[model samples]
Every structure is written in C-alpha cells, then in structure tokens.
Target: MTQPEPLPSAAATPAPAEPPSRPSLPSLPGLPDLPDSHVDAVELSGPRFQTEPAQVYRELRQRHGPVAPVLLHGGVPAWLVLGYREVLQVTQDAALFSRDSSLWRLWSAIPEDWPLRPLIGEKQESILFTVGEVHRKRADAVNEALFGIDPFALRDRSERIADTLIDGFCERGSSDLIAEYARLLPALVLAYFFGFSDSEADEVTHSINDMMDGAETAVESQAAFYTACRELVAAKREHPGADATSRLISRSPTGSEEEIVQDLMVMFAAAHQPTAEWIGNTLRLMLTDERFALSLSGGRRSVGWAMNEVLWEDTPSQNVAGRWPTRDTVLGGQRLHAGDLLVLGFAAANTDPQVRPDPAVSTQGNSAFLSFGHGEHGCPMTGRESAETIARAGIEALLDRLPDVDLAVPAQDLLWRPSPWMRGLSALPVRFTPGPRTLG
Candidate 1:
C-alpha cells in the first residue's frame, strides 16, 4: 500500500499537538535492536478486554504511561496508545505514523492462516488501505455518494425498516435486539441505499450478521457478501439509478470495477457493524442507566443524550487498526521503531484523566471523543452522519413502538460480546406488552 499523504484539508484544520517529549527507555550501548520483542509487552486480549477494559487500560497507563507495549493476536508485538494527546498526535501525523500496514515488521513471521489477517492483511486494494491522491479521490467519491442521500429520506427508510423488523417479533412480546433488530436494521437500510431489491436486502442482512458474528459461517458469509457486491456493481453499471452504488461507480476515478467492489465491501462492513453496535450499546445504556430512564417514554431529548454518552463511554469502535511509524521515534515515553504497529486505543483515550477528569459527568453534547476517530483518517463526516441517523432513528423507533419495554434479563445478566476490538452487547433481550401491530 502506498504511504498516506496528509489530507487536502490539512491546511484549514488546526495542527495537532507535537509528540510527547518524554524520553523512552534508553537502548543499552552495543546491543543489537530487537524489532519484534518487548520484555513488558502485555497481551491485548482475554476476558479483560471484553468485561473490564476501561479498568485494564487504566492499569496499563499506570504501568507503562500513555503508549504501552502490547501483544496482538498470535503474540505480535504492537503499541497500544492510551493517552488522549498521544492518540491525537499519532492519528494527526499520518506521514510519520503511516496507515500502510505493509510496513509492519512481522509480516514475514505472520502465518497465512492468522485470524487477524483477513482484517489487516487481506484486502490491501480497498479504500481503507489506499493513501495519497488515490485515497483522496476514493474518499471523496464515497463521501459524495453518501452525501447525496437525502437525510429525510434516509430517516424514513430507517423508520420503515425498523417497523418491518419490529412487526416480526412485536407480537411475541420479547426479542433479542442484538440478533434481530440492531444487527439487521443497518444492513437492510444500507442494502436499500446501495440499490438492493427487497430479496437482496434480506440476503445481505443475513450474510452481514453472520460475517460479523465470527461464527463458523463467517468465511462463507464473507464470500456471499463479495459475490453480492460484484453483482450489484455490475447491475448498477449496466443501468445506473439514483442510488449510492450508481453514484460510486460513476464518480470513481479509476473506474476499475474491482476497486469499486472492494470499496463497497469496505463501506458495507464499516457502516453496518459499528452502526449496529452503536444502536445496541446505546439502547443498553438507556435501559440500564438511570440517567436515560426518561427517554423510555419517547423523550427525544434524552435519546440524543443517551446516544452521545455511548459514543464517549462505550463507543462501538473500541480500538482501531492503527498507524505504523515510518522511522524510529519516541512517543509517550516509549520507543517506536519503523514498522511497529500502534493500535489507536479510542476507548482508553476517551477516559484519559487529562482531558476527562470526571467520567461520571455528562458528555451529552461533547464531540471531542475519538469514537468516530480523528484527523485525516478519521471516519468521514458523511459516514458519521449516516450512522447517527440510522442509530438514532432505530432507537427512537423502538421506543416509540414499545414505550413500556423492559429488559427481559437482569442488568447483570446482559452479557457483552467477547471481542477486544468492539464494545457491544451479545444479546439485548427485552420484553414489552404485546399490542396490535401497526405499520410505521
């Protein structure tokens, strides 16, 4: 992958803070450099990442300051940047800390069957991996396609989909929001946005849910998604419509069908998983936390508050696949050699005591949280708005339909999905009064 150039808008945006000046551990004289070994490296996974990650990040900060040496899947050495300032610095300076993962030093040692490879290794041609002028064009094309979506129409589509999904289980008086609603709504709406027919939308929803679940069917589900994307692009090319797929195909600079397909897959995965998690996490917070109790009665104000709070406290994107140093440098008092992977610890940074002194206070209107990320590589504004629209609309629709809904299981019994990278519920079982169905 080519190295990422600074965003074209860099000149207008304020400069990021300089890298922290704290000195790292001094290399002993006459010792050969160890590229892939760190004596104090902590494992970035296990029960702690799922259940008590905030506490774990806090402990890591105490042990290793802002940037801590950590082991990724398969004991791959990396740095987890946990400070707000450090994360900002790393994300902002894309030139120094490049987005190209090909720079990673341990690829020669990384097994072909490594689980994380599908995410970070494969799909190198996608927009997520592209940089420089090429990346800018692709990013612009994507934003333009998404921006063309009318907000009111998007909201209506979301509402209609939410109603249709709710209709299936509304009479049953109980449903697992994670499996049934939260996971499916975004995929269905996105399918519609990309010009999938009703049947294709259903297929997409099923496949995306399976793919994200990391189940035995994940590989097959991924293949199905790619096949569907190729078919969709082909259909769009032969007969363009007022849809995102058509817009993307028409505007893409390369005009390469494969490039467009890869980008669509990237967009689909990125848009669906996080938006689903956002809805689930926000609903979980509102249902469990007293602060959001009023929102249950269809209070629009508190719905927005609950959603904003989730972005700060339990962002769906907990950590992000990160930047690699172009050259040896010190960051947050830790030595980073060229090719060292640095995971952007968004969840940890949000809770950093320097910026957020009191976690108990409300973050209702604050937009500084790195939940949507920061700098040139941050989640694009159109992407953020579309996700927010989908999430807020989904939550509001559920509340409007089931005003008296309550958690079917005890608050303690509601388990989170055991993944290190995302913060979302495994199941949000809720029961409500069975009422006559109405099309929303």
Candidate 2:
C-alpha cells in the first residue's frame, strides 16, 4: 500500500530564517561509511533502526542539511527530522504530530489481538505508545501512580534493600552489578509499589527478569506478569495494603481485579527496563569518569547532576517517542505526508548543538539536553525536585555504606546492552572495602 499522504500543512511551514548552529560532523570511531551500493536499498528499506543509527543520523544531517527523508527499519518511509528547532516543533505540536503508531501501515501486519498491542500499538490507553487525548489521560494516571507515592516514606526500606545487595558483593569482592544489584533494586521497589510481600517481591523480580530475557516485546511477556499482578491485586483487595499499586487500585475507576492487574503489568513493563538501564548507566558513568565520581563523592547533591548528565550522554531510550503527521507539515524543511511516521531521535536530538550549547557536555547536566524530551509529551517526571530526592537518597546511602567502591575490571571490557532504544552496561563488576552494616 502507498504510504499515507502528508497532511496539507506539512508543506506550509517556512524554513527557519537562520541556520541552526551545530557541531561539525565527527567520524564514528569504528564504522564503515555509507556506500553508493545501498543508496537504492536504503531508500526502499528506510533508515536502518539498528544499534548504531547515530552514524546514519549524523551522515543524513550533514548530507541533507536539516530535513531529509530516510527509510527506517529497511522499507518504511520516515522523515529523519534532525536539528533542534524542527525536533522541538515536531515533539511539541500534538496537533501537527501524532504519537499514535496505529496509523502507520507498517504495524498493520500484526494481529489486533496480539499481546504486545496494548504496550506498543496505536490503541488508546497504550500509555507509552498512543497519542492524542487518550494518551494524555492514561499517561497522566500512570505518572501519578508511579510518582505519586512518597519515595521518602519507603526510604528506610529502600536503603535496607540497597545495603543487603551491596553487602553480598563487598564480601565476594566482585559481582555483576547489573544482574545482581541495579536490576534487583528497581524490581524490589516496584514489588513494594504493587503491594507484594517481601518474599513475594523476590518471586516477582525473578518472574520479571525471566520475562525480560524471554520476550522480545511487551506483549510477549504480558501473560506472565499480568498473572502475577492479578494475584497481588486480588490480595490487596482483600487486605488493602500501603503500597502505591494498592493505593492506585483503590482509587481507580476500573478497580476490577483484572483491570488493576493489567494496568500494573503495563506500569511495571514500561518502568522496569528503563529504570534498570538508568541504574546501570549511572554506575558505568561514575566508574569511568573520575571527575564525575569525585563530584558524587564530594557532595550528595551532585547525584542529581550526575544522573542528568548520564541521561544526556548515555540516552537509555533512543526511540522512546514517535509521532505520525496529523496534517501536512514541514519539519526541517521537508514535507511530510499525513500518516508518515516521525520517530524522535532523542539520541540525535540530545546531542544537537542548536538545542544544546555544548553537546559533549551532556555528561555535565547542561540544561538544554532533551533526555527527558520536551513539550507536552516530554517526561514530566524529570526535574530538580524528583532528581534530588531519588538520586541523592540512593547515592548518599551507597557512598555512606561503600565509600571505597572501584571497578574490578577495566572500563573498556564492559559489555553494553545491544538494543538501540536503551544504552546500558550489561554488567559492572566492582570491589569495595566493606563497612559496618549500620542500617540493615
């Protein structure tokens, strides 16, 4: 089928009066240059949506200037919208740009009843994937449920969990930080949020890890997680607990055991991977950058800065947000037909010079980084207040309990997650002098 036509307004926006300032293109450390051999292949297939799209994106920006059409994932036609202004416009204008992926013809191949549909499809209530009013409402509820709880109330319990994991590693002198520590912490927190008991929390964590390793998409893993969530919600209904999941279930309009369970699964699936990557990336940054590590060691407040820097320098989700053109619109001086898919390259946009003054300093928490995104659809959870609260507390506890922590292996030897959508170290082995267990 012919790709959807670009809405009329797609061609109406005038190009900016002045060119955006951006750093001169830099060669990737180790990658082949685009060949004339694949020019036709590329156009037919669309932009390659692989682990190293950054190189292709940089090349497109240089060759096409700002706005250019490129194929994505082999054959899907999409506008590789680069430059700060264009990206900002596309991300902010909900009317012009729609985040609904269902409109795209590419996803039509998947059956409507596919398990992954609620997680990645274009349907309303697909919190992370849908767009328009439905996206707004469900997203608001999810955010409220996720962040609405007082993380401080659980600080004591969280610290105990963090310390117990750290102690196990300090004794061994080396452990896979990602698999053992970073991954475990968030799952435990999420379990508490879902009102699972401590032992039940361990079970949920194991189930989540298994599901992540086993399934390629959110739908593939939903059945197992949904089952666990359903059990927990049923228990909460009988004996209302103090956890966030229970609280949300209590107040929800759709408080049936099934709906509550499904929503929890959606929330956990959306949050688990991203948060795990964040923790893994944060540890990697501290271990590699002595200057950054020193800053964290010197003051507890610096953790927020460090987290922001990591978000920019090591963007976890390369393709977190997407939009389809609602009407004809011009982004980066390229006309977009209605139904055309516009994938926001947070990785590319975060490093753009026009939007960020020193793209390289993204590691330094420059205010301009688009890590959390921008406009109405931007990640509302990021900002000074939340960052200070979460990072400071976690880092302070870590430093107080494990002051001499150092990587056991060379930084270059670390393995990174293979997905382009998220950047994270697969494992972090470290040795630290153990301190007296003061809290746990």
Candidate 3:
C-alpha cells in the first residue's frame, strides 16, 4: 500500500506549496460565521449514517479528501478522520493530537443540555479523558484489573450466562437475539466481575443500555451509572475482593475515589455495548451469509472468521469522539486549527481503499483493523481479550445448543439502530428448535 504523505508538525511552519482555492462552504441554518476552510462539510447524523455509512465515507473521501470537516449533533463543527493513514496519524501522536476534551474550543458555545456533551466529555477526569503520564498510570490500573481475570473461568462463566439467557426463550423457539441474548450477556458477566448484586446489576444494566442506545432516558442513565460506580467504589474500599472494582481500588491507591469511579464507568461503558454489538453483528453475518451458514454445522473456525469480518465491515464503534489538535497542523493535506475536534473514523479507516483495495476480500487472521483504536489510547490488550472471550464463548455456546437456528425474519427486513457513532442491529429475530431447559 502507498504511504500517506508525511503530516506537517503541529508547531512547524506550513510548506510553501499552498492548497488550491475552493468555493466557499455552503451555509447551514443557525451555524455561526466561521472560517471558509470548511467547504461542503457534512452533518454526521441523518439517514446516510444510519443506513449507508460506508458509502457515505467513500463519497466524503471523494469530495473532501481524507480529513473531511463534519458537523456533530447540535451543529458542532469537527473533522472526521476518514483515511486509514490519517486516523493513524491522529491516534499515534498524542502530543500533537491529545485526547483531552477540555482543549476543545467550542465549549463556551455549546448549550447546557447538548446531547453530545456526555460523549465529548470535557473536564471529566476519567481515564478516557486523561492524557500523558497520568493516563499511562490509569491505563495500567485498568490493565491490571482486567488482566487479573482468568480467561478460562471467564469463558466458562460466559457459557453459563448464555445458557441461562437462552433458557428464557429456548422453549419458545423464536426470539430477538439482540435484546434477549447479545445485549444481556456482556452486562451480566461484567456486573459479576464488578461485584454487583443481581438486583444492582439489573438496574445498572438497564441504565447502561439506555445510555449507550442514546435513548430518551440517556441523561438519567448517565447519572445512574455514576451513582452506581460511586457506590461500588465506596463498597469495594471497605471490603476488598477479587472482583475488578476491588482490584482497581487496590491498584490505584493514590487515585481519588471520584477518579476511580469515573475509570470504572469508562471500563463498563467501553466494554459492554461494543461487545454486545459485536455478538449481534457477528450473528447477523452468520445468519445472512450462506458462506457462514454452511459452516454452522461443525465449522468452529468460521465463528472467528465471522467475528473478524464484522469488525472490518461493520465495526460497532464506527466513530469515536476524538483527538483534539494541540496547535495548527496540516493532516492529509488539509489545515486543522488548534483545539479542533477530530472524530476517529474506525469503520472508514478499516475500509480505506489504500489498504483494503478489495472490500470483498477475506480479513480472517488480519488484526490490523482499528475497531478497538490504536496507540496509547487503544483498548487495553486485556480488555480486548476479555471481550473476545465473552463474545466467542457466547456464540459457540449458542451454536452448540442450537445447531439449526435460522433467521425468523427476512434479511432485507432487518433494521439498524439510528446512531452515527455505533453500527448495530436494532433487533435480530431468529427461530430454532425448542429444547429442554439446560440449567434445570
């Protein structure tokens, strides 16, 4: 693959070769007057993102090159890093492009009730918003907590969880796998690891699902999550255990309870929804694609292939809110000013024509996809492994129990959730043979 041009340093002077002039950016309603640099900036929402994001990214690349200017919710201006190389440049260089949301320049203009505020996360001390050496320490704490988990034990517990969930609907022979299985398994397992009682886990799981889905209860759900985490931190402090929350507390002795709570929130928020979506999307692939369906009988390796293909083709984490430049810089030949927000386009980068010349090609055993991100802020290795173990075990257990499972609805009739930041099915209805209860 051809290498992308070297990015000009954020503090360095621009090269003598100037970009060619283009027509002024088309105006949108209620947008404040700004520099004319953003020509034909696209809104990150709407039907295009929900229905056809890959095509949307391709069109944006064709029109505006790799680093395209885009409008977020409530018309917040930001750049979407759409190229594989551009995303790498942004993610790899923490000094130039920081994950600190407090550096964002538009905070004063943003409304109090701005929906995207939770995601942009300005002034939050969570590990997600931490940078530099402090971030490394927090990340280390998270890694230790997650790494302490035994993969074999996790896989076995996940199998039991999957069986328990399937028990609810296994006798019916028809179910919405997204709601009944995929979405619940990760929450239950994570909750157990965090030491939440069954009742607390149920409540926290509902709040998490509501927040991740961007539902009407999102604000309340966000508050609920914090409250739950704070309580967990307080409880774990007095009586330490082998649970992840207790481990995090013991690991970060110097960190504040608030910071620890926030980091726990980050772990739960990061792991739960994406893992659930991975399970849902992988199941969708297996149910729809004949190549995978044929392998359902005895082909266990195909399960891994389907998981990897989903990461490449329909990553759950489509866009991340994102790296902010420390100073003016030129990336992918486009000028970006100081404090500008850059949404990491994971799905777009995975499909960039430069690396993936053929979309139809198999990506099995290729782990270069940026679905979990890259560099210092990438998903911790331990976290990724736990998610994979949970997902793979969930899928394998379901297949083992129901070998003849098939889609109850037409493939064309399936609908995707309308969230620009996430790509997942709204519901995956399927039919299978009714079996005897396993846990009884």
Candidate 4:
C-alpha cells in the first residue's frame, strides 16, 4: 500500500518572499473607505461582541472591500482575509501557515512551560495544532476514533438526554438555556462517551468551565481539570465500560495510564467546549432571525442548510488553528520568522466573500468554509459519520421539541463567556412551547 502525498511545506513553496529585512505590517490594499450609509455603529468589544462581529464583517467588506487587516482583541494585529480565495489559501496551505500557539508567546501572558505546551506538542498537537506528515498521521488516528463511534446509538442517547432536560425545564416554565439546558446537554453526551454517570458528567462539565475561566491562570486550573480527567479515565479502565474512554484506553499505543489520561483530557477539551458554544450560538441565531427560525419550525426543507448557515455565521471558536513557522515564510504578504505563530482565523475565513459569494447561503460546497478548519491540521474530525450523526440527531431533537424557542431576554441582555478563544453565551434565557410528554 502506498502512502499519500505529503502536504505542501511552508518553506519550500515558491511565493513572493518576505525581504531580508522584516517589513512593517503592510497596508491592506484595495480597501474601500467606510460607507456613508446610515447604520447603527456596532462596537466589537464587551457586550457588543455577540452582535458586532457579523456587522463588522459586513462593514469591513463594504468599507475596506475584502482582505483588510482588522484589529482583534487587545489590538492584536491580524489580517482578516475576507476574500474567499485568499482565505482558502491560508487555510489549505499547511506549509505556509502554521497553527502552533507557542508562536504567539510574546502576545500571550502565559508562561513558556505551560502544561498546554506538551498537550499541543511540536508534532502531535491537537487535531488543529500541527502540520506535515506528523499532523497527517495524528489527524488520521483522531478522525478514526471520532468517526468510529456509532452515530445512531450516540444520537439515540443524546435525544434521551435532551428530552430529559427539556422535561425538567418545561415544568419550570422558563429556564436559562446555557446553565440548565445547553451546558448539560453537551456535558452529558461527553460524559456518556467517557462512560461517566450523569452526576459525574455534570461535575466534570462544571470543572471544565472553571478551568477555562482560569486559563489566564491556566497552570493551576488546567492541573485541576487534568486531575479530574485522570481519575475518570482510571475509573473507566477499572470498570471497562462501552464508552469512548474505555476504547481509547484499551487501544492507545501510549498505554501508560497517565498518557491515556492526557489523551482523554485533550479529547474532552476539544469536543465539549466548542460544542457547548455551538449549541448556545445556534439558539442565539434562532432568536435573532425569525425567518430562519420559522424555516426550521415550518418544516422547510432548508433546516440543514440553515444549520450550516448558523454555524458559518456565528463560528463558535474564535481562535483559528495555530501553527508554528517551521522555517521562514510569508503569508498574506507578511514575512514570518521561523518561530512565528500563524493563526488562520477560522471565523474570518468562514465569512470571506471570495469563497462564499453570499454569506447568507448555507449549502455552499465544503471547500469554501473554515468552520471545521482546513489542511493537514484542519479538523479531521469533520465529515466523520459520528459527528454528522450527532449533529443531525441534535438538530432533529431540537426542532422536534423546541422548534420555536427564542431568547427570553433581549439580545443585548444576554451574557457571553469572556474567553476570546471560545464564543458561547454564558447564560441564554429562553421561552419555548412544551413538547408532548414521552413515557420512559
């Protein structure tokens, strides 16, 4: 059996080279002047962020045209590659662009020896963390695991859990979607995969959120989260249950208990966190777009398309996959040193106009979007039957039970989680009509 062709290298590829002397951040060419149309000024920080990103995205396209360099949080310099082709180039070329977070050490306050450094190692980093052959091999392994799970069984279990939560909330009339429903739903699914009891799952979910909160104080909180994950893995091994944890522990090449625990922790972090945000964002999008919500409720054939549209429009992950510059390279016309951090802004890339001519359309072909990322380090977990099954099941369950659910509070009244790396509402209060009861 022959191996596949290796992904392109960042250094070897021919392109306009960055001059020997590093140039100052180049001015974005072809940007249009800010529009004179009467429109509400939307701030991109604080409470405004939830509503502002899409508007800013549209405004940037209108004012600066596509491919403008926008100032992100803390005024970090980042090129917003809004052109579809440009964004795809950045996303698809692993050699020219990197996803290693360590490259941005100077920009972040975290210490150099942070434990996360090992988790996202020089090679087998998270699915979104590496490039080249090393990235390809690891990605294949993770994808196999992710997709190997039975989707129907997973969805059946998820539906039961979602129904149970909805039943509990329906009696109470109004519920905080984030704390009561959305948070618990993903955590339960994750726990089930880890072979954890419902109670243990809830605890781990809370702990994960706490650790994320302490990311600025990451060393301590991450240590705590890892400790919990290790304990769970140990228990799963002893019990030998039918969940992902047991499977991974039994099959992992790194059979050491500690190594198994570390792998599980990495998977847990990647799977649960962003999923929670996706659920919350989906709810928020439904609230804001009544027509879209109506489409879902009215049984319009476009629910799948609408879901994709929502995913693209409100990307849950704010950080693009980070990569380390293996050698000197140039991206978006900016020269990067060998060790520079290259962030492929997935959110910015997803909204790029060149690839997605109409941001409103949900059914655009797969190659145009970056919600799941691209290239060797791109999210290999995507297109896995298991994830698709889960998504289909979750969406179906949501449509069946709470089709018309909308935010109980005004859009501005909602609270967003503060982590720039993740975008999920901290609490989404919503009102919905109760679904018919199901007997156990």
Predicted structure with the largest lDDT when compared to the true one: 3
Off by over 4 Å in 1: 1-37
Residue-level lDDT tens digits of model 1 in 33-112: 44443665656766667777787787677667899887666556678999999999998888898888788876767667
Q: Against the correct fold, how does model 1 do in TM-score?
A: 0.91
- Candidate 2 residues lying further than 4 Å off, grouped into runs, are 1-56, 65-74, 109-119, 122-125, 129-132, 214-221, 253-259, 295-301, 360-365, 382-392, 434-440
lDDT, candidate 2, at 75: 36
List per-prediction Cα lDDT, in the order shown: 0.84, 0.61, 0.86, 0.58
Candidate with top TM-score is 3
Better of 2 and 3 by TM-score: 3
The TM-score-based order of candidates, best leading, equals 3, 1, 2, 4
* Candidate 3 whole-model C-alpha lDDT, 0 to 1: 0.86
Residues 23-139 of candidate 4 have per-residue lDDT tens digits of 122212332232222121111234334445554455444543444443333222344444545556766665555665545533343335433344335444344554466555555
> Model 1 residue 6 lDDT?
18
Give the Å error, residue 362, model 4. 6.1
Question: Which model, 1 or 3, shows the larger TM-score?
Answer: 3
Q: Per-prediction count of colliding residue pairs?
A: 0, 22, 0, 12
Distance from true position, residue 151, model 2, in Å? 3.3
lDDT, model 1:
0.84
RMSD to truth, every model:
8.5, 8.7, 6.8, 10.7
